[model samples]
Target: MPTSRRYGDACPIARALDVVGERWALLVVRELLLGPLRFADLRRALPGASSNMLTDRLRELETNGVLVRRRPAAPAAATGYELTDTGRRLEPVLDALGAFGSTLPATGAHLSATSVLLYLRGSGRPRAAGTYRLELDDRVFTVRSHDGRVVVVPGEPGTADASLRTDPVTFNALLADPDALPGLVAGGSAAATGAVDRLLAG
Candidate 1:
């Protein structure tokens, strides 16, 4: 069993923090939320963590009743880790954390083109069966879904149906508060051309 921390006060928030307060623990949960269930997958998602540390954290979470392991049936011989119902209840907490992080000072670094592409890959709404394009500034991007997988490629201008041309900082601000986009753009702090409006509409 993992060692449990003791707090004099019985506040639920304190209790919950005690269980997950260790370094990389919450990130492990974030990887699980992104649909990686196997130990190897979790390890890959958290690049610098050692196998031993991963094992210990997994054991701790399981012991705390936040996660459970199950063997796959039939052809797949893998054992996967999944969140318990108690763990699933942490989704809102994670989402709120994400929202909070978006407002932090360093969040602007996460608004790169690759990050935007990954966000679209993970959360974009599917379109009618057809290819679409996205453009930002002098760069052009192509978006297509093949075999239920979304692909984003940087290419020439006319390739995408829409384009968004805003700097990383402005984009982060807009994501933090969509209503503020126009003011930023109007103030010459950011600029958008092509189908930028359509991309923001969603």
Candidate 2:
């Protein structure tokens, strides 16, 4: 059974924490923010979280209505996890948190796919303005940037001005330093062909 560690206080912030106060809870939410993910994929994305802890967090979050377990579809036949509407509401909060967290000193910790995508979404102010398809290790997403805002949607876009394919860490590296794109591309670790700087430039 999922346990609730309540604050016993009536404050909204306290109430919110009561549901997601446990360690690895928010990180799990972060992983699911982009799209649904199977257990193995979630585990790969959150390597530091133990299976038992992640399983517990998922269960608690599901019970609290932050996320829900998905049944397997015909072809895939693999169960997954996705955010509920209440869970999706946490995006702006997490976005604000991501922005605030970026100001602190560097942790030098490895960047996950969600972290990289969040960084690009929050900090990117691209000169380019069009849809760019990004294929990260976890899955596919479409990035559209215009003016100063960036929007990321799950799955392939109707059309893309360019495409970039790479793993999380390498993608993070290339995005953070666009100058490395050429070298990374030549090295075959990263591939991009389009106005990706619009999606990458922060």
Checking candidate 2 for backbone clashes, the offending pairs are none
Across 1-202, the per-residue lDDT of candidate 2 in tens digits comes to: 4545788999999999998888888989998888998888889888888898888999999989999998976875788999999999988888888888978988856667887888788774554678889999848899887777788878999789989999988887776588888888899998888777666664
Candidate 2: misplaced stretches above 4 Å? 1-4
Candidate 2: give its CA RMSD in angstroms: 2.1
Please state the error at residue 195 of candidate 2 in Å.
3.5
Q: Candidate 2 lDDT (Cα, whole model)?
A: 0.84
Q: Count the backbone clashes (under 3 Å) in each candidate.
A: 3, 0
Clashing pairs in 1: 133-160, 133-161, 135-163
Candidate 2 weakest lDDT stretch, 10 residues: 119-128
**All candidates: CA RMSD (Å):** 10.0, 2.1
Give a tens-digit lDDT track for model 1, residues 111-130: 33434454555454443333
**Model 1 spans with C-alpha error above 4 angstroms:** 1-4, 74-76, 107-201
